[model samples]
Target: MTPVLVALEAFHVLRPLWLGALVPIAALWWMVRARRAHRAAPRDGLAPHLRDALTVGSDGQRRVMPIDMVCVALALLAFGASGPTWSRQPDPFVAQSAPLVAALKVTPSMTADDIAPSRLERGKQKIRDLLELRAGARTALIAYAGTAHVAVPMTEDPGVMLPYLAGLDPAVMPEEGDRPGLALDSAQALLSRETGPGAVLFVTDGLDPDDVPALSAANVIILSLLPEGQGDRGLEAVSDVPVIAVTADGADVAQIDRLLDAAQARALLDDDRQPWLDRGPWLALPAALLMLLWFRRGWTMRWVLMVAAFLLTQPASQARADGIADWFFTPDQRGRLAFDRGDFRVASEAFSDPLWRGYALYRDGQYADAAEVLSRVETAQAAFIQGMAYLRSRSYRDGVRAFETALLRDPDYPNAAENLETARAIVAYVEEAQEQSDTGEDRGIGADDVVFDNESGKGEETVISVPEDGADALLSADQWMTTVDTRTGDFLKSRFALEQNRPAPSAEADAPDGDEPREDSSQSQAPELAE
Candidate 1:
């Protein structure tokens, strides 16, 4: 198709409802204009001379510019603000194939020549076919005789599984029994690392009815290589899963193809697919240029200026009523830009939106401020962030409270429970340290004494004693506390200072103050408490 035709075909309006609202606005405008004209008409009983004096400056001539021009401009502005869009361009798909584990039975029963080749060899062939059909899928192979063992770990390359398939022998198995349950368990273990949908394909003669429920949690597909007379009715009765039985002559290859097709369709349907691109902003430039033409000095310019001023002066919440702010830089968008550049102070100031202001403060290392800001929001995410802020600021009791609140809001919130335990441990240690200081036993402290290595899951304790020299030993015990506290406080205080002193946002010139606000000396003090 021609480019123009294609563009025309793709064109669509995002907010058609806004266009409907324009009808009532136009009607109101017309009614107000008529009312003004009617009120300005001279009284019927007035003398001609008196009327002439009252209308002294009136030229009795029509306006040079028609009111229709203003109406047309308003209509164009409305259409542009409604978000006109066109031309969908396809984005590259990030294909994610579900992991598949093929569990093959290596018992003596698999050696029976029910198929043209032995049952074991046929089962191996089917597994190879499945891997080839599911190209790019993460696959694993498990061999089972008495117990199950992972013959191959999960890998994208199907060829890695071929070596293990050829090496499968019943004699190699240390025990002899049919335990499909153990094989399913091994498959689940292999798939635990993967975060996508998973399936377990059983290539065996049959499975125990009781063991079928264990594989019910995952997608299960059974490929039976039993003899023609040995149907899979018993297995089907217990498990509501797909079972494809292959004879010695291999008459059910088409059924295998159908099953593979269905599986691929399901995967594509459930995967997280990206949405179409929005082209609404492409129309904004033309709309702006058209409005600029109406800025000529005249009554038309005066009317346009009045409308523009009214829109600009409206409060932020009211501006969003007509989506006017959507066409300009929103506070959240400005905050995100500043945050990305690591200018968190400016980001916090820019984020007038209550939802994101707390996060900006947290990133700025204003932990106490962040906790206060987030308390009002009171969502699971807000509570979690508040917990982190409190914890980093050495408010262990408050941190525990915030984390518990987060868990109450959402029991499955990640890391809330773990961090709560850490906070409790810190609180206990703080009490212990206070007791020791009161008893005059351990006056000096080391860096390891205060900091807990949560990542390594261990705490280091190291205390430095005072020298036995006569003059140094005579110093008060309180002096030792001051010296040790300074060393530990330096770590956090320096990091806080570094964060506070980052360069201002790139668009600082456009801010209300035209520059970043300077901090006073009083605001730079570091606390003596341990962190």
Candidate 2:
């Protein structure tokens, strides 16, 4: 279980280390040969028929004895030297004693009839279940609608937290908008009050962006409560924190099991402090016994049995090939085909497997990974694949460099020049885009409305307007407006007041009426943003 034990177990597999073991085998062979030659000399003068005969002398020496025993002993010695082992690891049943923090989301559309009992209600039920499952651990509950507010501070008894959570409804927080990032920050702050290694369970419909990176950085595990048919749509992250998923629409037990399996996989990778036993000593014993028997039974029919045992005990070389393939195409190989077809998502999933991660990254505009994958390739096709990955990832400089290097080895190559040009174009585009976005003057803010809160009473009335035809372009253009204020910004109090009055305008405009209101043509909200 200790680090030293693990290191020692791994060291036994080293060729140089195993070679030292061969010393004992060599000594055994030398001793056996000396004994055999001495025994054979006395029997040489006997008749040819009797020379090979088995005999029991009055001095208690036996000949032509049990070959099976000798073979079995040799096999044991060989097996011991090879260091076979079995580990009886402890059951991972003990639970953590740390307190937990739960962040529950209550959004406006949570009242949608799509889910039975509503998404918010069902989420509360699951949280209740999770709390019941947590033994006596303390937990805090946070309820957020448009914004977040702590429902229950950390408490050891779920019973104490249940009443506070029971009062939770969509109306608990003012209807501003769902912002999981802010909610997560509040939950994290609540969790910081507890002692020991605490965790957070954020149960939300995927209203949030891929918060995996942020949540993981916060050292909080995320358990996504996706509605049925929802999957990670557009997210990219390399997070150490584990994510478990459960569907709102009665998730199949199999899906839960998969989630658990994923969690376990992540734990194995991240929880290095977990115990692992040394199995080397157990294996060495049998290998030593097998080698002893191998010496006792000189080239005989018993080798057939030894071969069978070896075949049964040791996996064939083909297994290594299959392992490579599995690592490359884990869960599915849809990603590789998708990458080939220019589908980035599938390629990304396929890249999750270590074997293909590099390739996936390359196809997804990750040139660094492509170069790494290309470096690992052993075949000509791999070199070409690596080159293409580099090209697609927009590493035109690297792609051109790689192509030139490969061409020197094989002239008149196919497809290299075409990829080279593509990479060059991507490089040009990247440079241009970078320059365009960076230049202060190039970003046209005149077309973009500069909304300013007139807190500072500057007494000049200036009418700076654009033509109606160019109004949209002006609004859409990149612009930054400076604000002059004596007070530090605080929107929460104003937002709370607005929510209480129900004065928030509907995202969709009613009819355009001169008396009703002048539509802010410059500040139009997107349809989804209205939600």
Candidate 3:
């Protein structure tokens, strides 16, 4: 079938109920109009004057053209509002087959003419055959002589490795002897970042003693290109790994096919496969044109203009709820607006984008949750935000690590160097505090040990003890106070005074004549916690 026909066949409505209801209602409306026109007809035997009087005010009968036009316009509008779609959308999390690494030996021995062509030429042909057979799998190419090097990184398209494979030679290597072990290590390094199951295909005539240990630990298929009678005894002795031997003269296609089948079996499974293109929104243009044509009849244009105005002014969430807006204005847009307004909790809940959600959680003082969300995102901003979250949660070691990662991504990242220094200072403070608490030393107040409640009329002081087990609890308590009231920090400082063997400051003493005390200008400002 043609492409247009295929798309038309796939066309479906998101809201079919609107069209279904309109059909029956239109039929009922036409029947009722027909009956009313029949009843209003003049009687055959009526007097001329009476008939003239009855028919004078009436236009002979209602025109079917106007009613038909109205019904057709309404039907078109209903179809347009139903949301027609024809193609599938691409999803980022779609599963894929495991990547394959081809470790080809490029030593001087491969230049031998055992077959009609050289062994190296025949080996390249076999690699091409394997790639064609496993079309969906991502492939990487590695060349090894004395040292191994990656010629092509892992990619879904196998054609990328073909050019590099054509020029591969032993002269490119710095060292001289066969070292297939290094090639296997290079393949492993390439696959380390991938979470899926993978296979290492070792294409060589023979293996060295050192290569056997690395081959034992890997899921490998050793392809031997020796002549019929000559068998590598070292490979035959190793029973743990699977080996596929193909003689130069009699290289059967079936043997290579079996090798590919084994590689695919060892690879990862895929899920929720979908087409890459989404052609649903293409229908909107034609639907809009049809609506414009209907507006040539007066008053319809005004209605359309009013609807456009309402949608433009309405909040995205309300527009979506009322079915006036589509996926174009999604929850992520709403979350960004909420974040700008300083509604962190609302922004966190509204955001579908993972990066924005993590940032919102950090702003809401949910540090542990923020760290968990930010860990999946690999960006300098995400690392910096994660470091701030860790620092606020009293995890100084983790904070230091996160800051170091941010600086590595961008050395001139704003505030990263300063935060790193502050994180180190906090680490030292935590260690010193732990030692002091352990030895029970300095019961007498020091400069850092106490915070005086100057607003308290009784001149009470609060001791700030950094207990090993109570760090998270103290942070939680501080967060709760900040959430309840902006000026609760001093109240908490005074409340801690009661725990330090000092007299509790009464509410009456803090406020004279039963009125609240004057707010301190310095206390109203946010404290610099990074230092």
- Best by the TM-score measure: 1
Query: Which stretches of model 1 miss by more than 4 angstroms?
Result: 1-93, 232-234, 247-273, 276-531
Residue 150, candidate 3: C-alpha displacement in angstroms: 0.5
Q: Residue 258 in model 1: shift from native, Å? A: 4.8
**lDDT against true structure, model 3:** 0.62
Ranking by lDDT: 1, 3, 2
Candidate 3 C-alpha lDDT tens digits along 416-492: 77778877766665555554545434445433443221121232233445444754634436545675753322432
TM-scores for every predicted model:
0.36, 0.34, 0.34
Query: Higher lDDT: candidate 2 or 3?
Result: 3
lDDT of each: 0.63, 0.50, 0.62
Model 1 clashing-pair count: 0
lDDT of 3 at 158: 67
User: What is candidate 1's lDDT per residue for 396-424, written digit by digit as tens?
Assistant: 78888898898899887665676777777
The residue pairs found clashing in candidate 3 are: none
Q: Which residue pairs clash within candidate 1?
A: none
